[model samples]
Target: MKRFLSLALCASMLVASASAVSAKTYKMKIHSTGNERNQSTPPLRQFAKTVEEKTNGDVKVTIHFNGVLGGDRQATEGMQLGTIECGITTTSTLGTFDPRFNVFDLPFLFKDYETAYKAMDGELGDMLEKACLDQGLRILAWGVNGFRSISNSRKPIDVPADLGGLKIRCMENQLHVSTFKALGANPTPMSFSELYTALSQGTVDGQDNPPILTFSAKFYEVQKYYSLTRHVFSVAPLVMSENFFQRLPKEYQDVVLAAGKQYEADVRAATENLEAETIAELEKTSMKVNSINDENHKLFVEATAPIYEEAEKLVGKDIVDVARSCLNN
Candidate 1:
């Protein structure tokens, strides 16, 4: 009887210890260039939630939005150095490391979000992930920020000629600069954090961003007109340090990747749903919302054609060709 009681006590103790071990906690930080409510919010928050749930509260991901860590470039470099664990930033921001990322900047590259998603979730997405891995970063997933639109105080941009002599804020990417220059605007590449003040202070006459971003940043408050240029389809990548990722246990790595996939779905749904409502809300504030017709779109497209020729040299003609093929298919 004594032997049996001792064995039972040992088994109970082992069960308790195993439960305690399984409850172990891990923490990580993720940073982004936009504020918490921006389109990237869904994915960043969902990713954190999924990681915690998948690990049974063993892993915790804390998100820092709105350039809390730094600008996109700084955050990306920090990821590369393992100073920051994760970040979701524009492909334009990552272009400095891998010029191929500028392929996202190809004007009118994606006809719609469905086509873009197919490319990103399929072969091209895989290629981008491998490219990031080769450059010492791990791209877990891709998220969309929707199509970019033009907003400015100068005038309603009905045609490319209206952009002439207007100073516009653009992401710090050569493709962006070239596109604006081709359209006759003086493109000034600035960090996101500085955009509002630049708009208010008249340092810049206008800028372009997705509706959620323009709404969240309250850019409508300073600017008077919003044009649905839908010029470039924006993509944000969720990336981690390759070195740190490689150090994690295999199971943990799988957990993170799964969390990323879940986040992607959440972000896409949230962004698409919010776009129309955001535009309506902005219009209520008395900002003129103009939808450019197909005729005017031709002018915009003609203006940006040079951007493709210039970008092909930077990211290779093959990459441009592949992306263009996605447009047809």
Candidate 2:
């Protein structure tokens, strides 16, 4: 019995030593279109720093900001094909890969940040993440671009009726296109990478995004009116190449996954602070900023409620029903 125990301990030590010797450096590249200093850099910097510290430099994450890797869809496809290791892309872009992601493009699914977090971190996020994995992309963690609001070069949107006949640049996703069309706006589908040039060149008169993104992207320079329509809560997910993730040593996998979750929280906190700061800063700029009151919000809701039913056709009826239950419950 003593000899048997001694042999088992020797085997364990040998395996541990082998594992330590086998640890190899992995270079992971994560890309996004956010501003390097303002929007995209912080969480990625935190992630890279934490991962390297935890693994003692066994893994290094290279973050490419401002679409240097590619536009949202291109970067996502790069990761899916394993040419890149990871990407942080908007939910609208995810919808192009799988229609189920259209759920996030639904108008006014969440009323506040607290409710949005509850739904995303819970069952709704699970459902969407499963769809992503099934489609051959592994979601590391869900993040956000803050609540989207309307901005126009023409006029302030105090009500839904103000959107009529306006040409707006929206994501190329069908759901967003249909949502804007339903509200009587002429929605022009365009990539976010081209948004600034398009606005500057008069290709589109208006767009919508969080205040932070509006300021960071300098949309306020081209847009004269910033209306707090707060129409849709945008979702951005940190995703990794499933093949790359599965190929990692188990220890590295744990470290990488934990870093994704940690920096998700970090980015969320940073977004909250930046949203307020950007609003104040935009007020200082030559931009007219306005907010939607309860009556206007209700009007926007009434005009767009049919989108929920239309979304059922895009993703499925059952998941949309489940989403409604989760949000209400």
Which stretches of candidate 2 lie above 4 Å from their native place?
1-20, 326-329
CA lDDT of every candidate: 0.86, 0.85
Q: What TM-score does model 1 achieve against the real structure?
A: 0.89
Local accuracy of candidate 2 as per-residue lDDT tens digits, 1-329: 99999999999999999897766678889887876656546887888898889888877778788789988889989988999998898788888888888888888788888888898888888888889888678888778778899888999998878999999999777778888988889999887779999999989999988898888889988999999988889888889998889988898889989999987898888887888888999999999999989988888888888988998999899778866764464
Query: What lDDT is obtained when candidate 1 is compared to the true structure?
Result: 0.86
Best by TM-score: 2
Tens digits of per-residue lDDT for model 1, 43-83:
68878887878777777778887788988889989989988
Clashing pairs in 1: none
The per-residue C-alpha lDDT of model 1 at residue 189 equals 92
RMSD (CA, Å), each prediction: 3.4, 4.4
What TM-score, computed on C-alpha atoms, does each candidate reach? 0.89, 0.90
| Lowest summed lDDT window (length 10), candidate 1 | 34-43
